[model samples]
Target chain A: MSGSIAVAGLGPGDAALMTPEVATALADATDVIGYIPYVARVAPRPGLTLHASDNRVELDRARHALQLAMAGRHVVVVSSGDPGVFAMAAAVFEAVEHGPPAWRDLDIRVLPGITAMLAAAARAGAPLGHDFCAINLSDNLKPQAVIDRRVRLAAEADFAIAFYNPRSRSRPDGFGRALEILRDVCADERPVLFARAVSTPEETLHVVRLPDARPEMADMRTMVIVGSSATRTIARSGAPFLYTPRSAA
Target chain B: MSGSIAVAGLGPGDAALMTPEVATALADATDVIGYIPYVARVAPRPGLTLHASDNRVELDRARHALQLAMAGRHVVVVSSGDPGVFAMAAAVFEAVEHGPPAWRDLDIRVLPGITAMLAAAARAGAPLGHDFCAINLSDNLKPQAVIDRRVRLAAEADFAIAFYNPRSRSRPDGFGRALEILRDVCADERPVLFARAVSTPEETLHVVRLPDARPEMADMRTMVIVGSSATRTIARSGAPFLYTPRSAA
Candidate 1:
């Protein structure tokens, strides 16, 4: 039997956020591969084998999934959010590029899902309504200088910025440094959203001004959204609604 | 006899991509309000009233929906993609902000979906795998200079740029001018993806070098993605895979 690999997104910790296409792909796959948490999300079936790996072994995991597919096993590589956005899809292609030329022709498809930023945006009140930039703030794979430069330029462009992997145990200060850079360029009290574990039971949203935003507010599960200059807050009985207007002068 | 408003996304013309959360909102809604085509996407039901409006009347439509909700009607405002991204969520919030103070207490939520750029990115490879910025190219609400500045800054920052509403008949030259500006800053022949009517029966994807790209390649139905400097293409028998790696030096 010929085999294929589908890199699917299991959207922001919510089953309802998952696309039906992804659900169908998971049902058809013979093997599932991903980080432990993501792999745990897929229900175990009699015929399906689950290979859950630890964090930071993306390339190795990608290669393994490809190897299995080449061995005529339909494999599904799952990521917490959209695989294309800082997830397994790129790594899968990177493996395909380094592997046999024939491997490039394998049936590899990236199924998009509701990414964390968009999920966080929905939980908050459309903070990404206007022009926005998404920057992965974990300086592990990329250089800190590159992260800083992107943050500065994004601030200069006045785009609302969504930061993924803001503060991890190892890189606790990266998000703090990013906040300092924002403060230097932007003095306005534009609201910043700290959306943690969105769509989950532990989901907590904090809206603070640039002056009051602390790096401690973010963890590995948090998605930080800094609004554009035009972002505003409308206070209500419950959580305040935040949004950036579509028009930009 | 209670009321609320749900600004939902009808994921790029695909029933499979529509989230179950949005589906639940539609099922619970008493009135559905949106652009003509988007409202038409919802099926006729016994209890549901469809209020389809023309384009360019977003705020008016928003106000009407808000009024319906205020009058104790469960309303669902629909957009083609995630309502938070250049769509109806902001407009609904805007209406609430400008309307009576009591409107703030009304139940308003933004349900996320598979946005156009993400859908297009998945069909193509992970061209948006790295840091990227989303910019709306229509100058109806914003100034031409604003779009120019954003395109230039985004190019300078080396962020994969996603252009929504890239070209309409009335503003044919906006996308062309944006391309010219990208060419001025970026001499490299980065891959430009024109994904038109993605996830629909009329779906067509064109990958071209920046120099060869033309204005007529896009329309209101198209989403244009210009790859970052890190973007690369892998040749295959069927269609080439385009992706931007997750890491940068």
Candidate 2:
């Protein structure tokens, strides 16, 4: 059999949100490789093997997947959200770029899925209806200065911002500093959406004003969306509808 | 039957790219409303009514969907990409905010899908693997100044930028000006991807350096992605792989 690697996204947390393309890729794969939680989402079958690894060892996981594929195994790397967005696709590509030249010739395809930010935006109404920026809050790969500068510039641009990896056990203070910067720069009553584990059984969406938002509201599983100046709320009986209008002020 | 409005994304173009959640919503919907082309994507059935309206009639279409739902019809407002991203969700919310108070009581849900930028990014490798911003280059709702400022600020922040509606028949010169600003600000050989009709039979992807990219290379159907400084390419026999490294330089 010809060896291939398919990096597929499983969507946020819902099986229904996953694309048929990704589902087909998973079905055809001989080996599924990803972080523990993501790989666990895939059902094990008689012919399929699941290789779940630790979180921070993305490069090692990528190398392993590549090695398996090079040895005539069909490998699928599963990611919770779209693989291209802070997921396994880039790690696999990073490995391929620096690895043996023969790895570049392998059939590698990235199957897109419903990303967390978009799923979160959908759950909370259309807070990202206008121009928006998605920033990864974890400073493991980038510097805090880079995050601060990007947040400041995004606020200045008045773009709705979606934050991923906002708070983790190790990086608890980064989101707090981000909130402080937003409060300082935006200084308005724009809505902030704290969407945790969206599209899952534990999905809980909280909409608060900028002044009232706390950093502790978000965790590693949470997706945070800060509204632009134009983002407004429509008062309803239940949770208010939060959406950024197509028109700008 | 209770009245409901489900704002659903149909994914980029391929039927496989559409989520099962969206497919289920469409199957259960009594009426489907969207732009002419998008609505035409839906297969006609015995009971389902597809309202395919002309372009620039988003507000009217939204109001019509609301009216139908209020009359106890299950209406699905469809968009090519995720409904929450510069699509029908915001338009529906805009109508609800200004329309009758009873409209707020209706059951409304936004179903996320594979957005054009992400799909495009996946096809060309992971160019949006790092911090990125999505900007709508259409000046129909916002001013040209707002787009220019956001583009400038996004470039300054070194965020991989995705441009939607880069050029239209009515707005021909805007993308050119935006390109000039990018060239002036970036001033590097960073890759720019023009992904048109992604996932469809007519799909075409072109990659070029910043200086070599031209405005006419894009149209309303194209999703243009400008890579950040850290974005790189791996050359093989076929088309090169484009990806942005996870690490910041």
Candidate 3:
């Protein structure tokens, strides 16, 4: 008897934000698999098996979770943000499709959660109110060439951009390079919003011009949003928010 | 004694997608105020006061909810998607700022929830994998000049675009005008993904080129995602998904 699998979103932070369906799915699961921090989000429940690993081992962890589900154990694959938005859902589906035959029959559902971009946008009074995009600056899984191309395209198009996984100790200059690409195509005065650890205790939101932005301000936990050509920063009560409208109206 | 206010996001659709926090908030609220359809979403909980109205009266409803909150009645202002994403959250804030002085001391925490764009992107297998923007095609709140400018900017920047309130019974050509602006600036062959009632039982998602898209297929409930220059559609298992990459790698 193969048990089903649910890939649940834990949301930005706080256990209360978890959907009731996600909570029930995690509670009933015999095994839970995710990156270490996300796995820690759920408190210890009865009859639960935990699989946690570093960032590099996500594919393997997903496969192992699927295997557990195939072995007649309920499993919940967890992700910090929406699983499908550069989170674990794609890997789960990829593994299920390319993995062994026995894994094919397992039930799968991808539950939605609060994404960092949206949380950050909300915190900053709608930085994403207009046209925008999100780019992960980490070059580990993807190449620098590709990141450069997307950044150039986003900049050239003047789409507001949110930078995820923007910086880490290993790749100090990746964000810098991406920023350069954006600056080249967009105007120097474009607004760049930085939201670090959005919704968590350490959450911080900064709205600044492109020239004033610094790479040291971001980290793995930070999400960066850059405004489009039309995004304007108005000083209200000494705090600025980025807003773009559907129309000038 | 002032009653607290709860800001809730009803996910794209499907009551099961409601987060535990949102569910608990809705369940515990004495009154829920929102557009009529959103008010109907809450399960018939005992002791729940429902304030439903037409779409045009959102600001008025929000003011009424604030009055309830000031009068020491627990009230929840509900938005169908994430309250912040072109929804009720901003209106709530606006009302609080401009409403009667009695509302000044009230505590407000803008809770996070799923946005339709995110849910639609998830259902479409990551059309938002890279960078993107969401533009509302409705011209009621804004002018057509602003809409055309933003659409052109998004296309020039090559940002994936999610169009909200794309079409309605009265303004059937709004989406068509948006498409015209997009086509003028971006390639006419850009991929456009359409998602309706995302995450709900009536959810539907399809991908077509911009040139082939028809305004007749869209309505108020529709969300149209137009891919960037780099976005590509791949056929998998007899279904199509728009794929955008963080990097070409």
Candidate 4:
């Protein structure tokens, strides 16, 4: 009897934002595996076991889930946002591609969830309402030159950009360099939104012009969205509504 | 007495894909407005008044939603995917920006859901696991030159590209031209995933190489995902798994 592996997304932080499909997957799982914070999001039951690992061990986590499933355990690997977007789904696939040939025969499913960028965009209005690009700003996986080239081209292409993993303790200076490139390429006051811990009680949103954006404004938990030239803002009583119009002239 | 409006995403044709936050908004709404097909997805209850409008009238539909809210009616303007991504959220904000001063005072919120591209990526493998750009291939909103330039730059940037509205009845030749541009820039056999009506009964997925891909493979309902240079495919018994690796060369 072979079991299955379901890679699920827990959504940003709000429990209400999770889909019924993910909730059902959690209820049916005998083993759950993920990062420490994400694994903590799932409730423990009588028949379930939780495996929480530290950061930077995505490949190891993927292998553990695969091993459990191959051993006939119903395993669910959880990610914070959409599993397909810079999350556990990719890591699991990499493992399967390099692991035993039998791993390909296992039933593996990637369930979509409300990603951090989408959740952040919703909280700050539709900053990504038009054509846009989502880039993982951390240079751990890719070269810095690649990140620089993409940001410059994204500015030249006039696409709204959503940046994931903007800053960390070890990689604090990369985001500043990215900002410098954006300022060099885009010579305007385009709105930039730094949405931290979106949908959570500790969520905070800050909007600034491109020239006013600083490196320290973002941390690891923040999702930074830089608007295109066509993006607009509407000021009322509270925070202004930010959006890119449907039509681009 | 004042009323508010909530712009909610229904997700990609699956009831289970909808977020509980959106379900709550629909349950609390006195009026619901959306495109004809999307509005039909909502249940016909005694207290809810459903306004089903035709396509291309997004601005008018948005204005109607604002007017209903201003008239002290709780309204939910439904979009098929995450409202912030190429959907009703931008149109609603456009209406609010151009409407009367009182409209700005109306409480408006955007509740995120699983977008079409994310859902399609999930149904297939995690083809969008790396940095990617989402472009609306429809020329109705932006100039064809703009679309072509963005596609060229996206290919040059080596970002996985997700094309929305690849082909429509009114515009058939744009996707072909866009494909030509990709063929010229990429010059290699990258994978392309054509996912149509994902998560629905009519859902279909086709994977093809860049040279073998045809313009007719996509329709208006299709979400086309072109892999980056780092994307890999694993062939097994059934459909091959497509995913872009997390680390780049």
Give the alpha-carbon lDDT of every model.
0.92, 0.92, 0.74, 0.93
| Candidate 1 lDDT tens digits, B9-69 | 9998889899899999999999999999999999999999999999889999999998898
Residue-wise lDDT of candidate 3 within B25-90, one digit each (tens)? 887899998998998988777798898888866568778888899888888888887876777766
lDDT accuracy of residue B2 in candidate 2: 73
| Lowest summed lDDT window (length 10), candidate 2 chain B | B137-146
| iRMSD for every model | 1.0, 1.0, 3.9, 1.0
- In model 1, the Cα lDDT at residue B58 comes to 92
lDDT of 2 by residue, B1-249 (tens): 579999999999999999999999999989999999999999999899999999888899999999999999999999998999988999999999999999998999999988899999999999999999998877475777888888899999999999988996667788998899999999799999999999999999999999999998998889999999999999998888999887754
DockQ (Cα-based) per candidate? 0.84, 0.86, 0.34, 0.84
Encode model 4's per-residue lDDT on A93-188: one tens digit a residue.
999999999999999999999999999999988988899999987748578888899889998999999999899654677889889999999899
- Runs of candidate 1 with Cα error greater than 4 angstroms are none
lDDT score, candidate 2, position B157: 93
lDDT: worst 10-residue window of model 3 chain A: A240-249
TM-score of 1: 0.98
TM-score of each: 0.98, 0.99, 0.81, 0.99
Candidate 1, after superposition: displacement of residue B45 in Å? 1.2
Candidate 2 residue-wise lDDT, A1-249, digit = tens:
669999999999999999999999998999999999998899989999999998888899999999999999999999999999988888999999999999999999999999999999999899999999998877475778888888999999999999999996656788999999999998789999999999889999999999999998888889999999999899999999999998764
Candidate 2: docking tier: high
What pairs collide in candidate 4? none
Considering only N, C-alpha and C atoms within 3 Å, which residue pairs clash in candidate 2? none
